[model samples]
Target: MISMFVTDLDGTLLKNNRYITKEDKEALQLLNKKGVDITIATGRSDREVQAVFKELNITGHRISQNGTFTFSKYNENVFSQVFEEGTSLKLFDFLHAFDFPCLISNFDNIHYAKEIPMAQTLQSLFKTPLIYQQDLRNRIEQDFSTSKFMLLGETSELLSLEKKIISLFDTDVSTFLSADMCLDIVPKGADKRRALEALLNQTGIKKQATASIGDGFNDINMLAYTPHSYVMSSAEPKVKLHGKKTVQHVYEAVDDLFCHNLIL
Candidate 1:
C-alpha cells in the first residue's frame, strides 16, 4: 500500500496553473480519509503554497521553491537553502542583462516586472498580488539572500537562456523550466530530488511506499526517484519519459492506484 503521495501543483494538480479541480480535490480528500500522506512539491515557495492550502482547506507537507525549502505538515521547517550573498549578487547582475521579466523570491515572492502583461500572467498563475518594486538590485547589493530567480519570456528565448545559465554557472546553480515560459534558477543542490530525500528521512517513509506525480521539467528528478511515479498526460513527451505511468488527471492516478489496490 502506498503510504505517501507527492504532486506538483502547476500542471499535475492545479488545473491550468490556477486552482484545484473538483476531481483532484475529492481524490485528495479521499486520500486524507484513507490515511495516505499527501505532499505538494513545486517550484513555488512555501508562502504561495500556504495560500493554496488555505484555498483548498487541506493540509499537506510541502516541498516548495524547487526544494529550496521543505516544511512539515505542522509547519516546521525541515530543510532550507539560500543563495550565498556573493553568489546571489553575481547571479542577479548576470541575469539582469536579459530582457525577460525577472522576479526574485526569498521566503516571500516579489514580482517586479515592467511588463504589465507578464506580471498579469504570473499573477493569474500564482494568484498573488503584484508587490511591485524597482529596487531589487539595491536589495541584493545590500546583502539580501535570495531563494530563487525566475525569468519569464518566450519558450525558445528562455531555453536559450537556460543553456547559457547552465554553461556559465553550471556548478553553483540549478535551473529548471517550470513552465513553457518560466525558467527558474535555484541554488545548486537545492532541488526536488534532494528535498524529497530529506522529506523521506524526516518521515521515515520508505521509498517504495511513496508515489509521485509531476508534469514539468522541474518534477523530472523527483519522478525519477519514485518507482511508483506518474506524469500527467498533458506533459511534454520529454518530461513524460521520467514517470512510470501517465494519467489524464490527479484523480485518475488516485483512482488507478485504488483500483489496483496499490493504496490500502
Candidate 2:
C-alpha cells in the first residue's frame, strides 16, 4: 500500500501559473486526512517550499535543493549535504567562464553574484529576495557552503556549460538539467532519489509505500525511486518516460490514483 505521496512543485503539483489549484489542494487534503504522508520533493529551496505550503495550505515534509536538503513543514532539518569549499570555488570559476547567470544555494540561503541579470529573474520566479555579494568566490568560500548550485539560461548554452563542468570536475560534481533553462550542480550522487531515501529512513516509510510525481528532468530520479510514480502529461518526453503513469494535470492524477485505489 502506498502511504506516502512525494510530489514535485513546479509542473507536477503547481499549475502553469505556479499556484496549486483547488482540486489539487482538496486531493492532498484528503490524502492527509487519511493519514497518508504527502510531501514535496523539488529543486526549490526551503524558503520556496515554505512559501508554497503557505499558499496551498498544505503541511508535509519537503525535499528541497534538488534533494540536497530535507526538512519538515515545521522547519526542522532532517538531512542535508554541502559541497566542499575548494570544489565550489573551482566550479564558480568554470561557471564564470560561461558568463551564465547563476545562483549559489546552500540549504540555508541563496547567494548571487552582483552582475548576474538572471538572478533577479529567478528571484521573481521564486518570489524570494536575493542575497547579493560583490566577490562571489570569497562569499562562497567564507560565508556559505552549498549542497547545490543552480544556473539559469537557455538549454543549449546550459548543456554545453554542463559538459564543460563535468569534464573539469570529473566525479566530484554531479550535474543535471532541472528545467529547459535551468542547470543544477551538486556533489556527485546528491540527487532527489538520495534525498527521498534519507527521508524514508528518517520517517520509517518503506520505499514501496511511496509515490512520486514530477514533470521535469531533475524529477526523473525521484520518480524512478518510488514504486508508484507519475509524470505530468506536459513533461518533456524524456521525463515522461521515467514515470509509470502520466496525467494532464495534478488534480486529475491524484483523483485517479485515489478513486482507482491505486494508492492505499
TM-score of every model? Answer: 0.95, 0.93
Itemize residue pairs with steric clashes in candidate 1.
Answer: none
- Model 2: colliding residue pairs: none
Going through the candidates in the order shown, the clash numbers are 0, 0
Residue range 1-264, candidate 2, lDDT tens digits: 767888888777767636788888888888887888888888888888888877767688988888788886565778788888888888887777666777888766777774775555566667467788778688777857767888878899888878878888877888888766889998888888998888888888999888888888888888888878888888889888899998877777677677778666
Task: Please report, as a residue range, the 10-residue window in candidate 1 with the lowest summed lDDT.
Answer: 109-118
lDDT of 1 at 165: 90
Off by over 4 Å in 1: 113-117
Instruction: Estimate the lDDT of model 1.
Output: 0.86
Q: Which model scores highest in TM-score? A: 1
Residue 83 lDDT in candidate 1: 89
